[model samples]
Target: MKIKTLAIALCLFSLPFAASANPTLLEKTRQEQQIQKTHNAEREAGFKLTEKEVRAKRNALIAERNRLQRETELLSKSFSKNENKLAKLEEQLRLETGSLGELFGVVRQAAKELDTEMAFSVTGADHSNYDAVVNEIVAAKALPSITQLNGLWLGMTEQIQASTELRQVSVPFINGEGHQSVVQAYRLGSMGLIADQGYISWDGKRHVATPYLKQPENGPSVSVMSQLNESGLQAVVVDPSRGVMLEQLANSPELKDRIEHGGVVGKIILGLLAVGAVIALFRGVKLMMIRQQIKAQLKNPTKPGNNPLGRVLNVYSKAQNRSVEALELRLLETIVDEQQGLEKGLSMLKLLAALAPMLGLLGTVTGMIETFQVITQFGNGDPTVMAGGISMALVTTVLGLVSAMPLLLAHNVLSTQADNIRNILEKQGISLVAEQAEKAGSAA
Candidate 1:
C-alpha cells in the first residue's frame, strides 16, 4: 500500500512536468505554423502582383494590335485611292497628247540624229554654242516650244550654209608640236581646216584645230593659201572624208621613226655599213695608187722605183746570180708579198656584207617574238598592237638589204682590182725569170 501510494505520488509529481513539456511543444508547433502562414501570405501577395503586371501588359498588347490594324487599313485605302488617281491622270494625258506626241517623238528623233551628225561635223567647231539647244531638244520631256523648233531649223540651216561656204577665219589652233595659239585658218566647207603651216584637223569638242603631224605631199602650202586669200578662187586640196584621210596622214611614220622601230640591231647594221664603206674607200684609193705605180713601173721597168713592181724588179736584179729555178721561186715569193698588201681590207668588207643580213635576220626574229608575245598577252583582236613588231621586222629587213648591197658591190670591185694587180705582178715576174734564164743559157 505504501509503494503504491509512492508511485501515485511520483505520477502526480510528473504530471506538471509533462504538462510543462506539452505547453512547450504546443508553443513550438504554433511558432512553426505562424512561419508557414507568413510564407504562404508572402507567396500569395507576390503572385497577385505578377498577375496584375501580366494583365496590364496583355491589355497594352491588345491595344497595340488594334492600333496597327487600323493603320494598315488606312494605308490600304490610301494606296487604292492613289492608284485610281494615277490611272485617271494617265488616261487624261494620253487623250490630250495624241498627234502632238508623235510630233514630239519626231522632233526628239531628229534632234538625236542631228546631234550625232554634228558631233563629227567640222562646222561644229565654230558653232559649238548650238549644242545647248540640241541637248534641250533631246532631253525635253514635253512637246518642244515653237522657239526651240525654230532654233533646231536654224541649226540645220547653219550647218547647210557652212557646208557650202569656203571662208577664212581666225581660230584657236594646236600645232603638231602641241603649241596652242590663235591663227588664221581657212575653212574648206566642212571638209577640213588649213592653217598657214599645213592641214589642221578640227576638234569639235574643244573647238580648236590641230595641224597634221606629217602633211601630205599635195596638201595646202603657204603659196596656195596666199593665192586663195588674194583671189578667193584658188584650187586647194581638201579631204573629202573630212578628217579620216588627214588623220591617217598625221599618224603615218617618218623615215626616222621607221629606223627607230628597227631597234638596236638596225643601228648595228647601219654602223657596219658605214665601217665597210670606209674600208672600201680606203682600199679602193690605195689599190688605184698601187695600180698607177705598177703602170709607171711597167713603163720604165729598167729603173726600179719604191713600189711593188719596183721591189719585184730589184729582187730579180739581186737574184740574177742564182739558178733559174731559185730565181723563179724568189720572184713568186715577192709577188705573194705584194699580193698580201693588196688584199688587206677585202676580206673584212666581205665579212661585214655577210654579217649585215644576218643581224637583220636576228632583228626580224626578235621583232616576231615580240609580236607573238603581244598576241599572247592582248590577243590578236587589235591589229595595231602587232603593227609595231611587224614594222620592226620589215624595216630591219630593208636595212639589212640596203646595207649588204653596197658592201657586196664594193667587195666585188675591190677583189677584182686586187686580182688584176696580182695578174700583172705574176706576168711581169714570169717575163723577168724567162729573160734571166735565156741570158744564163746564152752565157753557158
Candidate 2:
C-alpha cells in the first residue's frame, strides 16, 4: 500500500512538470518558425536581385557583340574599296610611265652593274661613298630620286677620273710578314698597287693593300719602282689584266716551292744526278789525263814513264830481241791491259744514265698510285687536292730527264775518248810489230 502511494505522488509531480514543459516547447517552436520565415524572405529577395543583374549583363554583352560585328563589316567594305582604288591608281601609273618604266629598269640595272664593278675595283679604296649611293638605287622600292641619279653619275665620273689618274697616297698596307701599317703606295690607275716592294694586292672591302707573297720574277724591281716614283717619265711595269694576272703570278710556285712539292722522289732523283755528275767529272778528268799521257808518250817513245803508254813502250823495248811473233804477242798483251784501265768507269756511267730514267718511271708509277688513292678517298672536285701527287710525278720526270741527258752525253764523250785511246794503243802495237818484223827480215 505504501509503494502505490509513492508511485501516485511521483505521477502527480511529473504531470505538472510535463504541462509546464509543453508551453515552453510551443513558444520555442513558434520562435524558430518565425526566424525561418524571415530567412526565406531575405533569401528570396537576394535571389531576385541576382537574377535581375545576370539578365542585364547578358543583354549588355549581346549588344556589344552586335556592334563589333557591324564595325567588322564596315571595315571590310572600306578595305575592298581602298584596294580597288589602289589597283586603279597603279594601272594608271603604269600607263602613264610608258618609257619611264623602261628607264627605271635600265637605271636599276646600271646601278647594279656599277655596284658589282666597284666592289672589286681598286678605286674603291679611295672613294667608298659611291657604293652607298649605288646601293640605295639598287635597293629602292620606288622610282629613283633625281638626287640619287646625280650621285650615280658623279660616282661613275669619279671612277673614270680615278682610273685615268695615277696617285701616290698613304694607305693601309699589309706586308709579306702580315704586318699592317700605313705606308706610301702608288695606285697604278686601275691596274695594280706598288709600294717599296713590288706589286701588292688591294682589298676593296677593307680598303687596304697587301704585298704579294711572291712577286713576279719578270716584274719591275724596287729600284725601278723608286726611279719611277722619283721621275714621272720612268716606265713602270703594270698588269694589263688589272689584278687578275698579278694574283696568278703571286700564287705561282717558285723553283724551291716546286721541288718541295715534288717530295722525296724528286729529292732522290736530284741526289742521283749529283752523284752521277761527280762520277762523270772524275772519269772525264782521268780519261783526259790518260789521253794526254798517251800523246806525250807518243812524242817520245823511247823514254818510258809511269803511264800506260810508257809501260806499253817499255814492254815493246823488252820484247824487241825476241822473235817477231813473240814480240807481237807481248805488245798485244800490254795493249789489252791499257784498255782495261781506260774502260774502268765507262760501264758505271752508262749504268747510272740508264738507271735514272728507270727511277723516274718508278716515281711516276708511285705518284699515279698515290693520286688514284686520293681520288678514291676524296672526289676530284678540287685540283689542288691532287696537286701533290701530280707535282711529284711531273717534277720527278723532269728531273730524271734533266739528269739523264747530261749523264748520257758525258758517258758517250768519255766512251769515245776511251775508244780513241785504245785505237791509238793498238795502232802503236801493230807498228811496233811491223818494225820488229822488218828488222828481223833485215838481219836474216
Candidate 3:
C-alpha cells in the first residue's frame, strides 16, 4: 500500500516534466496557434494593399497614355495650321517674284549644267559654296534673293573666265615606272591638262597625270610647257587637239607594236634580216682587209702572197720574165682569179636583199588569207576580230621593206669596194707590164 502511494506521487510529479518536454501538449501550443492565426490575417491584409497599389499604378499608366495621345493630337493640329500658312506664304512669294520665278528656274538649270561642266573641266574640283547654293535654290519654294542671283552669276562668270585662262598648279602624278611625283600642271583652256612628264587630265574627281599611249612626236615638248606656264617668252609647239589627239594616238599601234601582231611571218622576216646583217658585216670586214692589203702591196710590190694584188704580182714574177704579151696574159689570168674571190659574197647579199621583200609579200599573202578565213568564219562586224591577220600582213610587209633597203645599201657598198680593188690591181699591173716592155726595148 505504501509503494502504490509512492507510485501515485511519482506520476503526479512526472506529468509536469512531460508537459515541459512537449510544448505542443501544453499552454505554449495554444499560444503558438494563436500567433500563427494573427500572422495569417496580417498577410491577407498586406496582399489586399498590394493588389490595390497595382490597380492604382495601372490606372496611372492609362491616364499617362491618354495625356500623350492628346499631346500628339494637339501637335498634329498645329502642324496642319503651319502647313497651310507655309502654302499661303509660298503662293505670295510666287506672286511677288513674278517673272523672277522663271529666271530662278533658268538660273538653277544653268547652275546644274555648270556644276557638271566644272566637275569634268580641267580645273579645280569640289565646288564648296556653289554646290550648297545650288541645292538650296533647287529645293527652294520661292525665288532666290538678289544676292544669291548675283553670286550665281559671278560664279558662272568666274568659271567662264577661268575656262579661257591658263593656270599652272602643282599636283601628284604617276610616271612610267608607276611612281608618284609632284609635277607642274597646266590647265589648257579647260580642255586638257598639260604637264612636264606627258599629258595630264581630270579623272572626274581629281587631276591625274597619264602618259600618252603612243607618245606624240613632240610629246615631251609638252613637258617644257612648264616654262610656258611660268614665263610668257617661252616658245614651244602646242597640240591644239590636246588629249583628244593623244587618246586617238594611244589607240593607234606603233611599228614595234605592229610587229608583234605579225605572228610567225614577222619572226621569219626578222630572222632573214639578221642573217643579211651578219653577211653584210662579214663582207664589209673582209673587203676592208683586202683593200688594206692591196694598198700595202701597191707601195712595196715585193711580197704578193696575202693579198689579191700580191698574188697578181707573184704571177708576174713567175712569168720567167717573159715577153710583154706573155706576162700581160698571166696578169689577166691573175686579175680574173682575184676578182672572183673579191666578189665572193656580193651576189648572195644582193640576192638576200631581193628575197626579203618577196618574203614580206608571202607574209602579206598569208596574212590576207588568214583575214579572209576570219571573214568566212565571222562577218566583218568588228575590226579588232580580224586585227591580228591584218596586222600580220602589214607588219610583215613593213619588216620586209625595212630589211630589204638596208641589205640593198650594204650590198651596193661592198660591191663598189670590190670593183675598186679589182680596178686598182688592173691599173697597177698594166702600168708594171708597160714599164717592163720599155726596159726590154731599151736593152734590145
Which candidate has the highest lDDT of all?
1
TM-score for all models, in order of appearance: 0.69, 0.77, 0.57
Q: What TM-score does structure 1 among the candidates reach? A: 0.69
TM-score computed on alpha carbons, candidate 3? 0.57
Worst 10 residues of 3 by lDDT: 122-131
List clashing residue pairs in candidate 2.
none
Candidate closer to the true structure by lDDT (higher is better), 2 or 3:
2
Tens-digit per-residue lDDT, 329-397, candidate 2? 888889898889888877887887888888788778788888988998998998888888888888778
**Candidate 1 segments whose C-alpha is farther than 4 A from its true place:** 1-113, 128-154, 174-181, 217-224, 233-237, 365-394
Query: Which parts of model 3 have CA positions greater than 4 angstroms off?
Result: 1-116, 124-152, 164-189, 193-198, 205-242, 252-255, 261-263, 285-289, 292-296, 299-305, 321-333, 373-378, 424-444
The best-first sequence of candidates by lDDT reads: 1, 2, 3
Q: Where does candidate 2 stray beyond 4 Å? A: 1-90, 218-230
Clashes of each: 0, 0, 2
**CA lDDT of each prediction against the hidden true structure:** 0.88, 0.84, 0.79
The predicted structure with the larger TM-score, 2 or 3, is 2
